[model samples]
Target: MNPLEKVIWILVAYVFGCLNGAYYVGKLYYQQDIRELGSTNAGARNAGRVFSRSAFIVTVIIDAWKVIIPLWIAISFWEMDTIILGCMAIALLLGHLWPVQLGFRGGKGVVVYLATALMLAPIPLVVCGLIILLGYQLHKNLMLIAMIGFSSIPLNLFIFYRNIELTVVFFMMLSVVVIMHRNGD
Candidate 1:
């Protein structure tokens, strides 16, 4: 893709990421903002809590694919470097945190970050998932487990992948994710 096309693609991806499917799903089923009821964040976990199982499944599927599909589309058609793709990933997370469709309110960004790790580093993603799950089970603190998992990304990337660029991206994304969830702590 040309430079202009690449820019357009990123913009489109951001918009897609920003769509508040969870909020709408919750409203349709529960007559409430899922975020306000659970974590007060317009995200999948909140949707899962305040709505039916089907709505939760739908929200998760939509949120996960929203992040994965656009990046896959960009990589398939565009000749952009990892750095540009990394920026696009950041844009996607930001969209989740501050979705224009949700009056600039948004989710905790876990879904988008999950998609990013799945596409960019599958091993780290799996390790992180396990850590989060195990941590949650052991400590019964989901946000703490999430922080631990996000923290492990940079360490795992450096130790295993030995990629400084990937480490940097992990650090950047982790910073944003943690900051967005600061109130939960």
Candidate 2:
């Protein structure tokens, strides 16, 4: 793709990412901002803690679908290159974590990463999910469980895909989400 088209695609992904599901769901369903409830942040776990199960489900669907739709459109329909795909992945996460609408505050960013990883590597994501499930059962620490889950992406990329740039992208995305969640925003 040309430079201008690449920038436009990345910008589209970024804007789509800025659609904070948890924040909006909370506001619409309960008339209360999700960031001001429970953990006082706009994230899946916080949304689950504060809102109903159905509301949390909607938030998850929104988060995942927002990434998946544009990504699928770009890759399958638009046929974007690896670099543009990587840019979309990074931009989506950044927008999710630091949306301008929320005053540069947004979700923990794990779901967005999960969606990206799932789209890029479903088998690895499955294995990672199982491991995370087991870890959650053993330790009961959400943060640690997520970190362990996120670790599988890099492992999958290095082992299965063997793409250095993608490996690096997975590592960076994992770090960003983990740090965002740990830092409480």
Q: Give lDDT: candidate 1, residue 130.
A: 90
State each model's CA lDDT, in order.
Answer: 0.80, 0.86
Give me the runs in candidate 2 sitting further than 4 Å from their true place. 183-185
**Which candidate leads the pack in lDDT?**
2
Across 24-56, the per-residue lDDT of candidate 2 in tens digits comes to 998888999887788777878789888888877
RMSD of 2: 1.6
Alpha-carbon TM-score of each model against the true structure = 0.86, 0.93
Cα RMSD of all models vs. native, in order, equals 2.3, 1.6
Give Cα distance to truth, residue 100, candidate 1, Å: 1.4
Tens digit of per-residue lDDT, candidate 1, span 1-185: 57786687678868877976688788877788776776677887777766767887888788888888878877777656777687788888888888887778888787788788887777998899899888988998878888898788778999988988778887888888888877872
Clash count, one per candidate: 1, 0
Most accurate candidate by TM-score:
2
